[model samples]
Target chain A: MKLGPSRFLGRRRPREYAGGGRKAAVQLYHVSKSYTAGHYALRDVSLEFGRGEFVFLTGPSGAGKTSLLKLIFAAERPSEGQIVVLGRNAPRLGPAATPPLRRRIGVVFQDFKLLPRRTVEENVALALEVVGAPRRDNRAKVFAILKQLGLQHRRFHHPLSLSGGEQQRVAIARALVNEPEILLADEPTGNLDPELTVEIMDLIAQTSTRGTTVIVATHDYGIVNRYAKRCVRLEGGRVVEDAPAHGATP
Target chain B: MSRAAAQLASFLRAALRGITASPLTSGIAIATIGVTLVLLGAFALLVANMERMLDDVGDALHVTAFLEEGLAPEAQRELASKAATVEGVASVRIVSKDEALARFRGGVGRGAALLEGLSENPLPASLEIGLADGYRSASGLARVSGSLDGLPGISDLTSGQDWVEGYLRAIALVRGIGWGLAVILALATLLIVANTIRLAVLSRRDELEILALVGASRAYVGTPFLLEGLIQGAAGGVLALLLLYAVFRLVLPGFEFGLELVLGGVAPRFFTASEAALLLAAGSGLGLFGAAAALASESRP
Candidate 1:
């Protein structure tokens, strides 16, 4: 792996950290999660995502792709094994510490998970709002991001009024609005057409270019092939393939 | 901003926005709280007024001691003096047998004819003994009566101790019943608030989950609902206060008139400021606690 300049910069210089880096953005060793006794959602898995690297987590439904994303966000704790993001050791992070870690990561769900009652702008602003960005700055920032996403025209419209692709774009805008260190997307283009999928991937790639460590979990082979990033494929709660985007064979 | 402050601000903003988003539901919740508070307030006022009336009646009561007919005026005067010295006795007055007969005759002028042909007045002379307020208990009066029985020239002695004792017991019983009812009603109020908040939480479960996922602490998620509960409780308290005031305004005049006709005096029907404040605090506390209980129960992992 070739170390990129983007890897060494502090989190403040988000744009300077763009491109492949040697340092791991996230590292998990033998991580396993079970909701109930003897029912494992994820088996022993070890993986590392480098800074500013764009990667695809490909797996079938119930293959623990969502669970993996959740673990990164500290939404679910591992029953066994070490999971670390940034510098914090997860599982060891108490309930009180989880929020600060979560603040460092931005997540986009497959459902676009936008609050239907809230406007497009509000949905994007929600990320900043939760972190207590000043009201005046939040409004300006929200508008700037909405305009960047070409959602300025529908900024005031409720999410339900938007098309599937548009809603997904809003979700991306929300995930990126905070300029977090790591971006985790679960099936970001799951319901979109191929063209919209490409557009979303381009936006995600652009986000990585801005120095966010982007990890997208999806079943879309076209997205993985077109993007030509690192790919980590999962099967039956275990990693089946981990390779560079072009050279990967499953 | 400091982290906790920042988190609190975020929670407040989100909660305010959420409540504003569903104005109709919030309105209903506030109204429910108000109505319940009003019911409680009205009940409290009724209890307060009943207690006041009992106090007034109790204050006027005195024990009457009838003497044997053979006791002379000197003996009656001595008895009065001795009665006044008893531990519970506030004051004592001697009533001669002739005066007693005259009073009886005056009470039944036409009926006095039914007692014609009586050779001598058969009525006993009496001493009226007023008891001190603190020592007006049945047991205390019984002690006085027992000591009076040992006095010389007191062939037969009678006091209104039995009736006074029964009245005291009745008052205590009524007060116990009133308090029991109040407690039951308060619990019911708490249940109502808890159930309402639980529904509110359920309706916004997705929002709460998202907030939680995004690093909103349990307190942040719970505070808005707690505030909602406080709002509901305060509104209810105000409503109850208003309802009580309205009832007192509308019904008190008629009640006072009836009481005046029966007891020959006017009585007031209003709670003191302290009493109202206490009631309001109680209603609000119940609301806040109920909501807190519901939130705590739901938020537990």
Candidate 2:
């Protein structure tokens, strides 16, 4: 894979060099996350995702897909072992360092997580606002992404007023507004009809062509088969299958 | 124009939106701060007037040194010149025994006939020592009185030091009570404001989660809430200022007699513009800190 710009965030990030020109965008080394004394959300899962790679996390209902995404974003620390994201150790990124790291990655949820009270444009602008982007630039960037998602006309409308597809599109607009290097979508199309599901999935897939590592966690085998991308199947918190994409990914 | 300004504008917009979304709770917080400031302002106004009257009285304060019996007029005049040399003594007037008697007689009104029974002048001759303008407070009076007390021909000395001390004590007591009340009310107001902002935080938990996912730092996510509290507090300050001014103008007349008792006919004055601004700032501080306390108590992403 051709190297994109290294946006490993601030100077304090550990293993920032991560030794020259490595292509791995994320690497998990026997990572385990547990919430209870005898139970594990993810148990000894090790995975490596290269830059610009598109992968699907396929699993049953409680198969630790969300946990993996959370760990990748530094939202959760591993109970054991190491997870590196964007050249920084995921578990060691302190509270101050996490946001800038997360800034380089975008995560979309099943519920579309748009602020209901804010207009669609404002919801998307949140990403840029956090980074103190100038208002004009924030507005132009937000408009460009909203236009890309084909929801520019709904910019002033609140989330509650939009259909689920449009709402999900707004969420995607927010996630992509900053042009993140990594895109994680946990069931991006979970609430949509099959038609909207493909529409959303195609939009998410288009991001990988721009050299963003894409990870979509979903239980629907139909989506897994349709995309035929590099697939990492998880069962009982462990990777059961790692299949290469049937077609070109990057 | 700049990114920091843009962020500030964003925070302000969010704060206004939060206020508009829950006008009732916001209004309650503002009203709480306004009421607290109103009582505090009232005490402040009263103390200000009393202190002003005290200051006005400072100009006329004097130390009187009574002459010993049989002191000649020349000796009395010499004592007056000597007292004039003391520090903080602006001037001295020697009132002879006959003048003192006459003044006493004239001051007794219709009862002057009773004083006529005394064949001789009974009042002591004294040098009335006027204090320098700057030397009128309790401490200043003490300094001048101390110097005049041991004069060669002077048997006794008296001044308004006791009265000045009493007035200062009264002012201190009022100021102490006002500050104590301010502290208690401010605490209550802060808690109420905190709870109000806490509810706002709880209501917007989803928005916060989204922001967090988008790489917003905790400060980024918490700023709007803090701004909301600050806005609420500042508005409350404005409310209290208006209320206090209205009362000063419209309602203070009914307490004319009370004002006379404290100010001695001196016109009451409202808080000056700078003082008013200070009150507003205090309100804003309370709101900002209240929001901070609330945010600190909250568990955020």
User: Of the candidates shown, which would achieve the greatest TM-score relative to the real structure?
Assistant: 2
| DockQ of candidate 1, scored on C-alphas against the true complex (2 decimals) | 0.35
Off by over 4 Å in 2: A1-22, A245-250, B299-301
Off by over 4 Å in 1: A1-23, A35-39, A92-94, B1-43, B109-117, B137-140, B143-149, B155-161, B179-192, B236-268
Interface RMSD of 2: 0.8
Q: Poorest 10 consecutive residues of model 1 chain A by lDDT?
A: A11-20
lDDT of 2 by residue, B205-242 (tens): 87787888999998888899999999999999999999
User: How many residue pairs collide in each prediction?
Assistant: 3, 0
Q: What TM-score against the true fold does each predicted structure earn?
A: 0.82, 0.91
Judged by DockQ cut-offs, is candidate 2 incorrect, acceptable, medium or high? Answer: medium
Model 1 / residue A122 / CA error / Å:
2.3
The residue-by-residue lDDT of candidate 2 on A1-250, one tens digit each, is 3232344233122222112254889877778989898798898876778788888988888889999999998888999877888888878988789999999998898999988778999999989888888777888999899999999999999999999999999989999999999999999999999999999999999999999999999988888888878888888888777775442222
Q: After TM-score superposition, what is the CA distance of residue B295 in candidate 2 from its true location, in Å?
A: 1.6
Residue-level lDDT of model 1, residues B1-301, one tens digit each, is 7667766666656556655766776566556666666665655555565556546755765667887768778888988888788777888888788888899989998998977889998888888777787755556667767767767666655655676566556556656765776677667777777877787899888877667655565665688888777766776777778877887788667776665643346365676889878867876787788889888788678
* Docking class of predicted structure 1: acceptable
